[model samples]
Target: MSIIIRKSLLELIFSGAFMKRWNDKLRPMELVEVDKQAHKMIVAWLLFLLNSRDLDVVRKRALGESLIEGGLFDYLYRLVITDIKPPVFYKIKENPDDYSTLTNWVIKQLRPRIMPLGDDFMNRMTAYLMQPEDKGLARRILHAAHLYASYSEFKLLKSINRMDHELIEIEESFIERLNSMRDLVGVSELLDEDSNVLGGFARMCGRLRFQKRWSQTPRVPETSVLGHMFIVATYSWFFSMEVGACRARCQNNFFSGLFHDLPELLTRDIISPVKGSSQEIGELIHEYEIRELNRVVLAPLKEGGYEDIAKRLEYLLGLEVGSEFKASVNMDGTIVEATEEQMAGEYNIDTIDPKDGPLLKVSDSLAAYIEAHTALKNGISSGQLHHALYRISNRYNETPVIAGVQVSALLADFD
Candidate 1:
């Protein structure tokens, strides 16, 4: 993709949405006060990590049967009751047997623009929702995510005014749960090494809530950097599915979208316009970002035997890796296979036939368009946003297809 496209993508991710939550009037909650997309993304990432555990094959097989029988959908049904008095909350509470209905409702709310995996996702979600034994890792992780979301929401509330007693109580309760369950998910190991790693990471991510987008424009609710990453990752996951991305490719695109701007955690969100001021300046910023990432993030992970995670982050952020290639193991499991020159030229990436790189680019553009459209609908006036909507519309119109997916038709849904 060209530099201009890249810049526009970043700008869109940074733009915030202006919708209100159903339960905003009930309490001093930050759900509708902060970036909704970012919170959803955080929840999704937590879900991803929870699902990636390497369970023993024998145990997994044994638990798999039990999971299917034990109402896995019911577990997910309860996890989404973040509000205490919402009608949905009472509806589920009143009718305990509405698991399938509630599960489908949640899925509809959470479903992306395009579901590449389709119905298979519910089965996969069943596996992720399984809790084999007492210290069920999946259940614990969901609880942890719930607590973290509450903690982060309360923190956002603190920024606008004095923290409410109810919010403080909620935050403290989450902390207590986190403290109790820290040992369940290898957070204990991280805590022993760096006593505050978990909390620090959560706090850092929450800081993105305050980092507003379109600083010069009038936005009803500004999008944060963290929220933008979540939206991009969500979009990428759907797009990846639409293009028939392999398992590995789907995971990569989802995670890459999740942490694409992680360097911003340390460097702050360097706006796209500044980054694209000139090629030389952009290169300089990239160098500085890498240097700081190594010093602040990667170096510690390496010292703590988290090299695998560090490398994954590097690949996702395109730190040391170039964007023009994708590599995968062949079915034979010995030699690697790569797309030839003509295929690579046609698809924009040399390694993966599905071309996740360009696929993510399209998702990024779509996310930007959504951000602009949402803001405009909410009465945020900005010449830049208007121009962006027009530019992206024209750009995607001229380029109708990407990685075997009909880009124009996919985007037409937004109209």
Candidate 2:
């Protein structure tokens, strides 16, 4: 069965941008749901790496997929049920019947977007949320990631919170949550928050919140690299499913979109124009990013006994293929570009570790187009943004349906 690319689904994911976090208290910087989800996933990945080194590769990938799906389930649920406070939501959750009714409504709204992934995925989302209990490693990792992300927000608002009467109770709740997750692997160090190893990873990702996209241009609800990454990752998963990508390919595509711009964290978000000014400059920038990624991020993790995570990162970033936009498969110890037929055929299996790079690239471009389209629609006009929207729209118009996504139609919705 083929999946249709629906504007509603894409819009639903982008809706996160408008969702303000900690709305009750003032914050130094804008806190948005999309960026928080991205930060949480990053922390979750680090925790996954630390805890799963001894696990088999199959289980490791399954765990990763579980976290991604489960995290999205929670995110989508929160998106619609936005008005309720956390305490109130938990109270409702305690009543299984109430939780089920509300969660079922959420599932119903999301079904058109999610059922394409298959019945199993739908079942998992319902079960994960409905259980409302510790569901083992994947759930623990999700909870810890959620807590760490919230705590990061808390730290930022600490000074502001100091003046608020409810700050103490909120702070104590965070402390209690952290204490509860101390038993989680690699989470104990996060308790220190300032000097610990896991905290360092979280901080680096958190800093991305400060690095807003299109800095030269203004937009309502300015998005961060972290938020943009989350949108792309979400889009990639949706696109991957539409293309009937295998489980490995789908997960690979999603994570690749998530981390594709991670090197930008090291080099800053160098605009495409500047990067493409000259072949020499583009290659030079690429070489620099690769060097820095290995030196600062990867080597340290590998040395710290996280070689598997480092290796996977290298693969996802297309260090071997020279670009993450190229479809690829690991074949006989070498990463090789694979054709559509090959991907749909023998390479679909998880053992080969296929990645739908081309699909990810489409998702990446869609995210960018939405960003520009969103700004323009919000009345923040600029030559650069218009040019971006025009370029992307025309590109898809020229060759619509990239990797099974109906690109032209999706763009039409913005018109």
Candidate 3:
């Protein structure tokens, strides 16, 4: 059954961009929920990589799906209850009966926007929210990633928060919770200031918040590459579900969307125009990205006994089939391109380890369209931004229905 990718849901997810973090505290930069959610998922990826090293493919896929689902659940719930402070929210969460009531209310409020995702998502969301604390690996990873991402922001505000009496308890609580997770594979490195591989990787992901999207253009909320990746990731998951993608395939799409722009971290955010200026220039940039990615990202990871992570990253980055935007799947150990029909039919099974690259492309372009549309709506018009909106709109106008999604209609809804 092809599901409707509703306009309200897209706006609801993108709405996180406007939701502020550490709102009451003095901050150097505008810390938004979207970017923090992105960072948390990135941290969760490393944790997933570390902990799944010994698990089978089935177990690995289950854990990956749980992490993605849990993150989305938490994000959606927070979107509805925007005014509650972190301390107050946590206190409420501590009381199971009270939190259960609050969760039910949040579900009621969000159902209208999220109903397009269908019943499975709704049921899963409720179960995850109501699940006992620390009952699963996904929950533990969630706890660690939240603290790591929050602490990254808190460190920046330390100059202002140090003397604030209210934050003293919060500071100690963060450390103590993190201390309990030291046994988790990447948790120690995450907490360590000087640890090499994992520490460097986490820092690089966090630094993406400083790398603004559409750098040449002025916008209401200048989004970061990290935040944009999350948007695409979220869209891919929704599209995947709509297309009835199998468990592994859906998870693959989500993570592929999440890390799609990682090469940008090493090469910086090279705008699409610069890359497409000429065939030679595009090829040269691609060549450089591959060389640098191997050296700076993959090589170090493999050397640190993370060959599996490196290999999967290579696949998700589309190193084998040319571009991550192209649909492909792993058959046994070989990577092969698959058609949209095959993705919907034969290749849909989890054993194929399919990644719906075409679905991801739609998600990627839709995200770009929304970003452009949102900026223009906010009265931050520019020739470049307008061209972006036009190009993306026209690009999908011809065949709006891609990978079972009404792409053209969804784009039109933005207007």
Clashing residue pairs, backbone N/CA/C < 3 A, model 1: 16-223, 38-227
Cα RMSD (angstroms) for every candidate in the order listed: 7.5, 2.2, 1.7
Candidate lDDT values, in order: 0.53, 0.83, 0.88
Which candidate number would show the highest TM-score if scored against the true structure?
3
* Candidate of highest lDDT: 3
Sequence-dependent TM-score of model 1:
0.70
TM-score, every prediction: 0.70, 0.93, 0.95
Q: Candidate 2: misplaced stretches above 4 Å? A: 108-123, 192-194
State the TM-score for model 2: 0.93
- Candidate 2 clashing pairs, residues 3+ apart or interchain: none
What CA RMSD would candidate 2 show? Answer: 2.2
Instruction: Please give the range of 10 consecutive residues that has the lowest summed lDDT in model 1.
Output: 1-10
User: What is candidate 3's CA lDDT for residue 277?
Assistant: 97
Candidate 1 lDDT score relative to the true structure: 0.53
- Residues 111-144, candidate 3: write the lDDT tens digits: 9998878888889898887875756898889878
